[model samples]
Target: MAKRDLRALMQPAAAGMFMKQFLRWALVCCAGVFLAYTLSALKVNKAPSDPWAAHCLSQFLSDARSFSTATSDLKTTVNDLSAGDTASLTHARQALLRCRLSYKKIEYFMEYFFAYPVNLYNRAPVHEIEEPYMEYQSPVGLQLIEDLLYGEDPFAQKQALQEQAAVVQSTAADIPASVYGFEATGVQVAESLSQELIRVMALGIAGYDAPVCKSGLPESAVALQSVKAVLAAKTAGEQNLYADSCMHYLDKAIVLLQASTGFDTFDRLSLLTDALLPAQEYLNRYCCQQYPGIGGEGAYNYNARHLFRPDALRQAAFDRLAQSDTAAGLVALGKLLFSDNRLSGDNTRSCATCHKPSLYFSDGLKGSPTIGNGGSTRRNAPSLLYSSYQYGQFLDARDASLEKQIYTVLQNPDEMHSRLDDVVRKLDNKTYRPLLRKAFSQAGKQITPAMIARAIAAYERSLSPFNSAFDRYINGDHNAMNVSQRRGFNLFMGKALCGTCHFAPLFNGTLPPLFNRTELEVLGTPDGGSLDKPVPDTDSGRFGIFPIEFYQYAFKTPTVRNAGETAPYMHNGSFTTLEDLIEFYNRGGGAGIGLEVPTQTLSPRKLNLSQAEIADLKSFMLALKDSL
Candidate 1:
């Protein structure tokens, strides 16, 4: 300030300056310490390099590049098809096959990691109606191209084919950016391989994508080879027995698929039982050995040995509520309620009246008699076997779960003709009260509609007894299925295209690997089994529920597991015998029989199955009957 009256002011000013200098030095030191700490933390938190991620990224990029190139070539070839010449058509077809092969090589990763984008690359050829929004997405990608090129007039569809090929090439070009930073762990790679195997079995062999081209067998071989390559990359230099066994089985399967005589003649049963199943078992074991504490994060149970193993799928993953130890008690109570006629309005009919236990839970009638005998029920009663595994229930797939399905049936006027509350009240007597109390002890002496529904659903869920001859055959009893049954199984899975909708293991509408959705198809079933005078069934089926145009007359694909005992097939119960039913499908549903079924999803082309083949198919279905 002032010179402090000479010496005093000078001393005060000098001391203040020294204090300021000390503070500056302290601030600089603190900043230096903070910077060092930040650097140390950054180094500590840095992720370790993942060899699996590196290998997967490399393979994905390589395949993506090949796919992009193939699709570009496909587009050019398809454009040339506008000339409408035989040579142009042949070149286009060959280019399309090459494009498909390239796509299959990378399908596992694309489907596993990027489902939404991949849809544009290989969705079903049909126009898909997105529910709620009702957005109709016209078919695009390889399937549509395959259909167009193989249709009766490929020349007429040249422009459309060219557009689809362009879409596919554009989608392929974006693949690398879409998976730019994807880090694949060993467990995920293993899980992807397992899921790919299911896809190959269910969709690949069944000609799901190559419906017209009949290139499914070769595509499946390429897909399997890609899986083998991934497995080898992961287990490189490892001498584990499980790894060796997995490789051996995969090699055997690849060889078998490559040497296939034709799609219809391929021994699918042997390939499945002897190669795919065994390979899955060994691969699962190897994964467990390598990554002991890791677990899968989807519907599939990565720890399971094979697809047919009881624990292969996490069943609880599909359930709306988590299952508990009380399920056993709930199942017992449900069984009692399922048979009690008192639950019906008139107390004269029960679930067993329609779904009789003696006939594999299906009444041996064209359609079961209505609750009070006015007219027959609209649809035939479907068997309760394996009903719980599906995402939707009933012929129309109107119900999302077994519990909801039971509730609807209890309240339907044409069925039980009773409300859930009425059923609960009827079951409050000594015969059911104690059982209900034990099953739902946490509810504290209250009997509710939900409890009844849960109990009945639990009982239905308990009916999935995978102990049929087919199950035994797949699980290592080579003699369980006879030669006729084996041939039939192959026909059903391969030539018949049954496995695409009625997926294996469960043999129902539920899609596997990711058991997230149930599919419905418009088969255009006739009103009666008269092929000469075929008429489309009046029942609207799934269209009654969703009201989507494409879903007109669509119905859930019922399991053929116990077709032997559950006669009178289809929603209308129009076909009275297995032979007649096979004949109907052989002739190609209603459309093929000259019925006006505009939305018929079933191919109108004849199956041309021999009588012996039909007999074999029946035998295979009969073999699906459980040992109940």
Candidate 2:
């Protein structure tokens, strides 16, 4: 152990430590350089600054904060209702109404951008059936709370009401995070405004959301005000004529809403045609001018002038074979096949057998007779007119597409009783082979059942003529619909709540401005249209398909168009006369007549339509009959 040996060992250790420190310093410098380069690249690739979008985002955040605060207040008020008196209940309802007003202000953006969270805030107060998997989602949100508070005994369901309010409050708190960094463009703003206008007309004025409170008019006015505010924010310093026009119409609409006497007496037709439609047109035009060749996603055609226009919706959006070029030829072939009995098992029945051309594609019978038997089909034959425009087919909505519906009918024991494969083989004749080849020239030589379905569907799609008197009237021919018809149209769209489910101008279950899902409602239709002794129809309807308790007696809302020609109404064809059908609705479906329908989606409240109003409604429906 010499002093020189100890010094040598320390020197080697010091040299190793120095080398490690130098390497660490070099790595840090490299990391700094890389980080600087990455930052520079990010800056270069960043989207250009949009002042309009920035302003909207700022406004959205502010509105979202207000909504959150209002919901918190509502939650607090609801909590107090448990131990408080009638005054406390009144205060809770008032707080709920305040929350609704605040939510309405931001509903357009929230619904368009954040649909999932919006469901928790204000979905239809019914058990929603999640498709394919058939998951039953229990109803939550504002609508449910409204139903509870407005019920006969709100105190009895205090626990349920408070829970729903909490859901709304919690969902509201996440609004800012849900919309963080959401880039709002002129196209989106325009589309969202147009959609809001449609919502206000179809659902709002019809009292779809305000089921019990009947505060749709005031709520709609607030919504329009919010829309006006957003438009002003976008066109803050711009010299746009369309923006000015849009604002003018929006103001008129808000005024009309505010001036409304009551839900049943609101001049919804005037507001729709004079104010909302004009506002929608100008807003769409403004968006088009601002962002040319740009369109938002969905079933709506942004380029269309108004909702009532024949081309307002992208019809092809619902069809699977939208891009097919042989539509004309397919329609012709389908027409022949539709009437040909060779596709049926007994060669005695055809699609045309039940769907008669003279009756507007519906048989005049209560229910079409079954093939080769003394029985009848399970449900009444719905008119083929405008059937292709909807997302769901059949009264029960078991089939998702027209093709599937056709196939099901063909194979059903009581209907065609012929397999699709059999039908394809039956169509191998010289008359059909050539037509099939010409229609499906793109496909291989062999014909398939799907080809048959597609051909038939093509013909069905062509069935939408949009040439009814109502259609003509909406398309600028004011003389088409008479005064009574016009008045009826107003009632149908507003007080009667027909437009809420049977949305215009299709007057079917297909929802707009995104006509993606078809709605099924439980009207609690009776087995027979007897006002004295009403009995709920035993038909399981949608429950047969989904097996959910809420789906019991749920049936697809069929189109009311051409009802004058297509006589027997309801899935069972129980009501023979239009008057009886109207009476049934006036009495509030089956529930109003004392039927116990626990899952009835239709409101049990009576419509209380007058005799004159009923006549007007009938007149409007008659006007819907196509010239064809």
Candidate 3:
């Protein structure tokens, strides 16, 4: 009876087990169906037919058509204008204004790809610098024509105006073909838009472009319209909410520009704070969310909260110099070698002899004295605070690499006067061997001159500091700069021409977008700042090494970062005070003092800065005192 009961219980248990298996299979099938549905939904919602690039191309073509037509009309108007003036000059001005509007439609796009040509066609005539290879140029573009055509002597400038119109027409004709072949990514477009917007806000609204014409207000409206079109094209279809947000801010900016009146009377601060800044902020937000890898460049970055950040630039510079080694070890070994006197011929002096860290890495002397005995060096010992960021080393830019610069200085009779072989032999001795082992490990086992040079280079690369009050102001701390400093900043970027050479952020010669190469200038520095009896300094400069006519009297543009601390300015230490140095630049260097420099790269025209303006500029330079 007991066995039969047990068998009966087993039968019910088997049936329960089958039921459980059936429920498990049914639940799995339902989950698979739900997953498929979710994936299908995502595919439908995320996909858009006309992507950002497609919309951009379509808008570009339309803008090209408008530009071509406008140029043709302007050309006809110019041809009709004569001395008697068959058509009123006012009508011609209207036509010119229309043409500018059409061009503004694709301004940033063209400027980004064909910057060289665009600059040639549209650059202001102020403080134009000549290069070694290029021919001398006068102001020959739209701004020059604007000045002449809208001046008191429009009738007198009829022929010149007509010629300028023809040049502009040809340039406009080339835009379509140039734009069609060019390739660009969405991030690059954003960068160009942001930069051009800055130019538009800072220069355009200030009547810099339409100085004599007083068409800044209208021209700004048209420029804003072009920006609007670009934003519209990029954010064409659904599934781009971030771009839509960008479009909203851009639309508001256009409205602000359209409503603004009086070129000289318009509130520039309002436009900057309200319209431009908001649009820029939104665009930056979109870019960071969409493409985190792509970055905004030197003058501005939508990704960056402020206009300037030196830490990022310094890191970028360091990345280029040291590719393999740990920065910590390399810097440590470099610091040790920097102070060690064993590298010298008599083992009595080292790099620290001239470059003292306490004095902003400068020797505080007019010229670098000899290491062994006391003798004078021809050139001043430039502070090495940020020397590693420069491409060419030394006052003449003779050494292409920092390592080579060390070697050159070491062997120079007036400097360290040590042989590389001798230095390497000394470094391999008991005192330095252990430190080398800690820095380079296996590579340090057999010491060489190159290794020592690299260690020193690494330390030099770590020296540039960008945390200054001016930097803070540009980086979004409005309170950092006082009113005078702000005015000085404007003058620096505008009439002063200091920014034309010592570029912002780095405040050096490293060009933007690709901050790899450096530029040299022939400033025609005088032997003394005495206006009563000025004489041109006779230094062969870069020509000594290159032996080229153009390179004569050319020296590297040094960083103006620590101008407050590093004194006895210029290659020869001619100016003893900052005020005197400013005066020298204000008078347009040696050429302005009646010295003949045939290949003088610096413009030989006085800046004519007022006393207040001079004080303001000085204030700005002082603000660059490194916080670090």
Over 1-628, each residue of candidate 3 has an lDDT whose tens digit, in order, gives 0000011112455335423533453464356446646655555422113366556656766887888788778767767776766466777878878877777777776777666656535655322334434432334456655655655567776766776676667656655444433356777766667666655754565454554565666776777777767766666555566666656766777777687655433544445555566666666677777678556334234456423445334344424455454644788889889998988999988898888887778877788888667778878888887786667889887787778889998898889989999999888877777777667766436887888998998788768777788766665687987887777766665555566567655777765434556778777788865754788888979888777655678889888887888888899888887778878778877777777665566655576888887897788888888854
Estimate, for each residue in 1-628, the C-alpha lDDT of model 2 and write its tens digit. 0000011112455335424533553464356446655656555432215776566667778998999999999999888985549898999999989999999988888777777677677877665576666754555678878877877678877877776787688668756544433456666666677678777767777776775787888999998898889889878877789989999999999989898888777777778778888888887788778777545445777688878777777666786565473554888888888899988997887899999988899998878999887888778999999887777888887787788898898999899999777888888878888789888775448888988888888788778788999888776677888899999988887777777788877888887657877888888789877877987688999889777666888888889989999989999999998888988888877777888776666767788999999999999999999877
Q: Candidates' lDDT values, in order?
A: 0.78, 0.78, 0.67
* Least accurate 10 contiguous residues by lDDT in model 1: 1-10
TM-score of 3: 0.74
Candidate ordering by TM-score (highest first): 1, 2, 3
RMSD of each: 18.0, 15.7, 22.0
Worst 10 residues of 3 by lDDT: 1-10
Please provide TM-scores, in order, for all candidate models, with all chains considered together.
0.89, 0.88, 0.74
Give the worst 10-residue stretch by lDDT in candidate 2: 1-10
Candidate 1 lands at a TM-score of 0.89
How badly does each model clash, as a count of residue pairs?
A: 1, 0, 0
- The residue-by-residue lDDT of candidate 1 on 1-628, one tens digit each, is 0000011102455335424533553464356446645655555432215787578768888999999999999999988875558999999999999999999999888888778767677867654565446665545568777777877788877766876787788768766655533456666777788789888877788777776677889999999999989888877886778888988998999999999989988998888888988998898788788777445445677688788877777667777553552554777777878898987898988888898889999998888888776788888999999887777789888887888888888888888899777777778787677777778775457788888888888888788888999988888899999999999999987787767668887887777767777777777788877889987688998788877666888888888889899989998889899999988888877777988776666666687999999999999989998987
